[model samples]
Target chain A: MQKADALVPVSAYVARAALGRLAAEGSVKVSETEPDWAALVIRVRDHGDTQAFAALFRHFAPRVKAFLMKSGAGAALAEECAQDVMATLWQKAHLFDPARASVATWVFTIARNRRIDTLRKARRPEPEDLPWGPEPEPDQADAFELAEDTRRLGEALAQLPEKQRALIERAYFGDLSHTEIAAETGLPLGTIKSRIRLALDRLRQSMT
Target chain B: MTIRHHLTDALLMAYSAGQLPEAFSLVAATHISLCDECRARLSAFDAVGGTLIEDCDPAAMDEDSLTATLARLTGAPARPRQVDRPARGLFPAPLRDYVGGDLAAVKWRPVGLGVRQAILPTAPGGVARLLYIPAGQAVPDHGHRGTELTLVLQGAFRDESDRFGPGDLEVADQGVEHTPVAEADADCICLAATDAPLRFNSLLPRLAQPFLRM
Candidate 1:
């Protein structure tokens, strides 16, 4: 059914519904969707909830497109990549496990990996270089631990000094290498390294 | 796994930010799969990546993008829900894809006395490979011209800095040099990546360097 989805010039969501039906046609059982976006993903998986899938696409697609553009993809390529990524999210919704990561985290990881895959395809000729299928969930036993980390992560990021936070933003979102950042900020390379190290140490301490 | 050595905070941050080269990414992803602590650290970074993306200046998508995507989703194929209960091997799925199965399937060639290596097909400007060293064997003494990431898959190896065992990573830069000798009683295996050629100490290793592709 997935192979079929790739061929049709029609809408990808329609393709997904057909895929969902193909799955249901089998002997497998469908589960109920949860309350949040992550659960909505489950709905898209188990029942082909077009409404749920619509909500997710509306929320993530623009952000994903922008993210790719910042990561060096041209505007046209970013649009194309975002479309495919959202389609993959629907097709692979069954792989979602709320116990491991929140919906945003899961989606962003896919976005990040997908960008890498696209960039690599142009430069390298290897097919298997595409990371992996989907990630295995983090240990469920670490939920409490992960929650604490998540909570502290926000607080810790906010607590960073303004200058360090600026550096972090450039490093994280601007997708700048140390050299690029150093040039942009007009700071010495040593200064950039020290600031990043200090910020990471703070984050590490807060989480652990 | 109790990994004694690890990728530096800087490298992990680069990996999390999607700025690391392809080979270095393989090292980070493989080690992250084996070590929960590092994996957790990386996930935290991803959360930060999420917030950063959301805060980015919004790009205006096409009017039909959403409607088109939704239409495509309808025919999306269903992926199987059953995940591997315990993730059945030492290597992660990415590594297995490159090596084409598990440890036994690897086609290793001799690099030195009791040392074997198989170079992976990585993007240009970086070289990635699998190295298997028999117990008590020592890799040649060398300093790095660029970054070298060595993530141990099995057994242990000790260098001038410290000991590295399974899931442990040694991130070497231009300033570092050492002889890595595998632990006794068990062979050591690693997924290593290098951005530049090594600076070997002696003539013999240098003579063999071209053949080893180091």
Candidate 2:
């Protein structure tokens, strides 16, 4: 089932038509002349567009699977986690806002949350009546522009002091908190926080 | 701003990497939204994380795995709506800023008068190490059954070897056994990661074990 009208790339047109057909089936609604495709996807998601959701899933599913596998999840668990993340994207598409984050960022966030949830569930008994946090508001910016900002971000992070970098890595990648990091590195928690703060401030300055 | 009130860099790093608890991450995200300085820093850290992920050798995947995954997605049923929310108001800026927003998300169940324990969820199939100590009190004389790592988030705690302040990390092997008393005027908040459980000499703490996950 293909529609033949090409103002943009054929793939884009195909994707658009597919999404439109899905919407016709009461899965999503797509408007013509929407400048921001990512925002459109988000809107479709908010409206519970299953086809749009499916397309998004098709795009990110492999990457999510790869990410989980790399993060030390076994094959079965990674597959389960990847599936869970895609399902979440469909279920929570309405929560996404293109201005606040990129499609990748949003999708990755869903993946991250799912991974964390899976981990938590596998560990302790589920807590009763846990509170949910508020959703972040969207920013009014183009997603493409954020790429440049993120590029500079990479440079800034690379320039952090070696100790700061190590501490940051341990905390972020190793998943250790400030106290745990201090214990691991034998540094003061204040020092760890200060180093991170200084590093962040410097990075911000450099990016600006 | 009081340095002790802000979250430590390490914790911020963890938050950026999606390693912090959801509750704390929520606070950190809100803080970063308001604090451009922290946001930029977090972005940089995230960049580093991206780089690490890229540089890490992608362990080989099973043959035709991508094809199988694609099929699974196409065949999979649409996901139902489910919202997984973090705790609310649990981490106001005051506490979040002090501990880098990570500790603020834990469900602190009181262990004793002024003493509380929060057992953070570890990675899947990972160890179940818990943080134990008084909220604003001193940690009793104790030793580790396995390697223990401690990082002070707020206030000060003095052990036999040194006094730990905010952002300080103490790596203790099994040989070290000491009591850490919080400064009388300040509350002691620390994040601890251990491979094995703590062995408290006192009967009271041992009795509290069933209730406490640490």
Candidate 3:
């Protein structure tokens, strides 16, 4: 079988998470509300829960700001972008489907796309379909699976070989394409692609 | 349809990071809608993106930013969003938004050799179009000057590399060259995007390129 074909069963994933190396930290952790963030966001939407919204903002805003800064945004612009992301969350809270996306994925996707939108000087109308795109069929990552996957992602990422992990950050966060990464790092295109593929395999193995 | 061809991890990562042009992202998004596996994997990539954000060196924000955001929230009523669920048809949500309607509504202009095309208006310099090929028909043999994402929305097509069925996305670049022929059973409809013009091998196709605007 190809290396990429080694997708683990859910039991293996559970075993991996139970080992504690799999629980990754992030911007927010809901101690009182715990894992059901979809419900928490729903509370923010239905009842206008200030506490939940505030909690989300406090944890994510600084990180979103930092994210934009990494993508070469000025401090002032990054802050504005971060604020826009938070406002979008509040405004679009009803669209949060926990089954389809973890809170971390949903928030960061907003941050990533917002960075691009702000960078574009022209203000064009975005199609009804937002950046996250559509999720029609049921995904394999159920809420329980997503909770485990999100908790474990950081740990799995941390365990990657230094070079692989760094490349992943550049690819996912720095907004660099594989070819661009090769150019920046002075690595061959083939080398960068293979390293990233291997890194993703490890992440999938460790995440699953 | 069993999806055999898929966007490479590198391509998928580029799409997730917004490094790809809008045209490439549009094709990726449309294929992702129909392929549950790709959607699931993309979610993982998105989560990874979120983790990277948390790990960045903290950038200080405006002290009054939180105060401002909070103050604005109280005045702004909760905006309920009506998600536009694309009707179950040949066109998915992303494609529907560009086409402005269902598949039959497409205004296809001839692209020679029984192939029809409707170029969707997107950001300048990035070209995305819908292709219709009758069964057993073939796209002119060609390579790409830049990246091309060909997503099969209906039926199947085969190139030099492999066969692609519904929900399969073929990511092509300059180094790859092949003729993609639709399967015999049904006509093929694909959403394709290319950043640069194609490199057709034949003299006639190459000569006609300026006219096709491909």
Candidate 4:
């Protein structure tokens, strides 16, 4: 069998195992392909896979660093955050479960939280002085294969009314919550939440 | 659920971007979790995020950065660890559950009586922007000088033409004019995008124009 085909059965078994863990942990079930494969690899790779881990680090680390820097962190600080995020990935590799979230979603969540931490530390203000609570746990949303998944996701996103797409971007990337979104957009909060719920449902159905 | 009660397009976009306030974001996330259609839309938005990153001009990194990182990782000793503690505290657990995680770390500020606001520091050129507002206060009646996009994050409000709630997106032409008043019991929050400043109708509003570029 081709190397890819040869890996299928093992991948399937690993995916099932990971899913079991995720189900026990109360995370979302993996319903997509790339996440399933990546989860399998994560479960099987021993700590000795330094080279492979390094490759993952190389691809993701810079991106994480860039994201932080773009969001206002200094280069050095961004690098530190990125390093910490990758380190978390290395230490928590065993936790990767396709049933819970996609690889990109997981990685991005790590970066997102790290960025939040960095932001918190940059301030001289104490914990009591903080207005909002700490960041939420990263979503275990399903990950898609980079090439095809991205293409399909894009198509689906484009299919949404332009208004919906804009709101999702603000929510996911802009970090504005529903109330803030209402104030900024001059819309009712109920209307905003309803649209987001509908849009998310549509996107999920489309992907499946 | 009344389909009409569903979030508007603009609100959904904002929710996907993480731009809504905590109170309203929770509601949107909860609804999305139960609603497969919204989840699919959110996935599509994530794809768009991926595309934006792919399209963004790559910032130049030091030539040795990769090498330095690799060397450090290789030399680091392996240590047993648990997955990091899940985020808690900032928002109520019920709201956090619906958001697919990630609802803390935003900067919130009081914008008016009974209202607080926060600006999400994402996107470089200010082409995309996010803002949060609290309940009951009325955003002064105003019109956009250019195309403006707004998404409700939390609570509910009524403009002249319609009522909006969490996850609703409203795109206004330059000619649009209205005042958003929050619902009696809840605060209103939103994410808005505009090319130019808002045009106010009165003296106080005109005075505020310089301070509020929205």
Best by DockQ: 1
| Candidate 2 structure quality by residue, lDDT tens digits, B105-198 | 4667776656776655543211322244544577854445654556565567887878777555565666777877877767776655554342
Q: What are the TM-scores, per candidate, against the unseen true structure?
A: 0.71, 0.47, 0.73, 0.41
Write one digit per residue (lDDT tens) for candidate 4, span A60-89. 667777766766678888777777876677
Candidates' RMSD to native: 11.5, 11.9, 12.7, 14.2
Clashing residue pairs for model 3 = A13-A208, A22-A152, A24-A151
After best superposition, candidate 1 residue A135: deviation in angstroms?
17
Model 1 chain B poorest 10 in a row by lDDT: B196-205
**Per-model DockQ:** 0.20, 0.11, 0.19, 0.11
Distance from true location, Cα of B85 in model 3, Å: 4.6
Which 10 successive residues of model 4 chain A have the least lDDT summed? A123-132
lDDT string, candidate 3, A6-95, tens digits: 122223433433443334454343234344555657767766665556556656788888888878888988888888898888777766
The lDDT of each candidate is 0.66, 0.49, 0.67, 0.49
Q: Local error of candidate 4 at A33, Å?
A: 18
lDDT of 1 by residue, B39-123 (tens): 6455556667665565567688886777667556556448555344444676776688777878888889887787889988765
lDDT tens digits, residue span A156-176, model 2: 556767886666555544345
Top model by TM-score, which number? 3
What is the clash count of model 1? 22
Tell me the deviation in Å of residue B191 in model 3: 1.2
Q: Backbone clash tally for model 4?
A: 103
DockQ-superior candidate, 2 or 3: 3
